[model samples]
Target: MSMERIATALDRVSAALRRKPQAGIHDDAAATARWDGGLRTRVLHDAGHELLTDMPAEIGGEDGAPTPGWFMRAGLASCAVTRIAMAAAAEGIRLETLEARASSRSDTRGMLLIPEADGSAVPAQPLEIALHVRIGAPGVPAERLRTLVEWTARCSPVGCTVEQPMPLALHVDVAS
Candidate 1:
């Protein structure tokens, strides 16, 4: 879809969430760790009394352009970075290219059930990831730089959560 269309759709989703009452968000501080065969997942909330997450980059994403599935992928990507960027920064790592793409594999029986995940491990959710990272500070050695990335992945709240699920939930979505 055109970027304009995506923007409009994102506007609507954002508007809807803003309209929700603050008291509606529960837990503010609680969640669970999920394991499906091999993939790991986590459901966390510092919703802090807010009903939704503060990922403005996404809620304001291309309107219905993302369809719900695409939107979820965006969130997955955003959160993946959200949970790791700090670690990279703390280590004083300089990053140039950091791209993580998520994939899904679903059975003929049912797909698209991931969004319904209520703070639980949504199998086949982000089935595979192709990560391309380039980091080289003025003085950091390549080997040491690689370790920083390893540490990031190790502490990646979302990716690390899904390392063991066999056949994990793998599916793809087509924006209609």
Candidate 2:
């Protein structure tokens, strides 16, 4: 969509939101994942979109698609960029270009069930996840842009998830 169109759409949404604040309330979302075989998995959403995840050949997978960690990083980057765009529109900040990157260092030994020399399992968590955002809006003060990026990180869902621990539950069932 054109920039003008996006601005118009955001304006319409803002107007409607102002008119009826309750119109923006949402409570729940659902998605599903199915394992095909080996390390291959397919994630399905109610919106008719699908994502494939797999492991690399070194980890005993055929390398059919990206790993789950890659998807997580991609999601963080995409969500950050999207939220930044929406916030910029709401604040009437004209941006010529925006870029976001998410990255982390992780040990796969535990995930792959590899034992250390001391017969201990390596930690499976990423050391840290970093987000980098670059904005190109001429004449805009660098301080203000930096503040906007920081605000975007605070408001983005994926960014929050990476920064804080959220409640999660899991259940296992067997198919007859």
Candidate 3:
């Protein structure tokens, strides 16, 4: 979509929220994933979209697709870029280039039940995720560009979700 269109949509949503804050609040995203026997076959469904996740052969998968962590990183990177663009549009900045690099670091000791190099236990998940965003817009000041990037990081949904911890509940059911 064009930047003008995106700005218009954002303005519309902002107006709606301002008019009825409570009515505008919603959280109803639902996705289901099903896993079959081998090859790290996991199919996820959300709304009308479907995503397949798999692991590499080194970890016992057929390398059919990217791992779940990879997907998460990609989502973060995509969200950062989109949010930056949205901010730029709102601020009337014509972006010439925008690039976001997202990376995560994890230790296999936790999943593989191996000891850490220092004889300590590794965390159950990745230790850190990093996002490096570079943006360019002619005639825009460097300070304004930095502010846009900072604002995007503050408000991006995926980035916020990754930084914060939320309550989770799990249940298992068996069929006869």
Candidate 4:
């Protein structure tokens, strides 16, 4: 959609949200993943879309698809891009170029369950996640674009979730 349309739509939503703040708080549909075989899985979303994940051959997988960690990084990049674009549109900034890249460093020892020298458990999460964003808009100040990117980082849902600690619950079912 055009930036003008996006601005109009965002304004409408903002007004509605201001009037009924509770309307913004709601649960999203759950995504279910089913194991397909050795280190491969298929995830189904509520919208009938499916995503596949697989480990490399070294990890006993066929390498038919990308690893789950890859998907996580992709999600982060895409979410940041979307949020940045939305903000740009709302602010009447005509963006000529916008790109976001997400990268992380992880230790395989943690996932492989290798024992540490100090006997401390290795973290399964990435050691660091970095997002590099390149954006430009004709006639817009560089500082303004930087500020927009910074604001988008704080507002991006996936970014926020990854940055903050939240409670998670797991349940198991036994089948006969």
The numbered model that scores best in TM-score is 4
Index of the highest-lDDT prediction: 4
Q: Can you give the lDDT of residue 110 in candidate 3?
A: 81
lDDT of each: 0.49, 0.87, 0.86, 0.94
Give TM per candidate: 0.40, 0.85, 0.90, 0.97
Which model is ahead, 1 or 4, in terms of TM-score?
4
lDDT of 2 by residue, 56-175 (tens): 999788899999999999989999999989878767788988999899998788676788999988878786889889997778898998999998888898889889977778788989
Which rank order by TM-score, best down to worst?
A: 4, 3, 2, 1
Model 4 spans > 4 angstroms off: none
Off by over 4 Å in 3: 115-120
| Per-residue alpha-carbon lDDT of candidate 4 for residues 1-176, written as tens digits (9 for 90 to 100) | 99999999999999999999999999988989999988999999999999999998986999999999999999899999999999999999999999999999999889988868999988888999999999999999999999999999999999998899599898999989
Q: What is candidate 3's lDDT per residue for 1-176, written digit by digit as tens?
A: 88899899999999989999997778767677678557565555565777778877888888888888888899899999999999998877899999999998998668777877788887867888899999999998999999899978999999998898686788889978
TM-score of model 1 (CA atoms): 0.40
Candidate 4, 113: how far from true, in Å?
Answer: 1.8
- Candidate 2 residues lying further than 4 Å off, grouped into runs, are 2-28, 113-121
Worst 10 residues of 3 by lDDT: 36-45
Each prediction's RMSD to truth? 16.8, 2.5, 1.9, 1.0
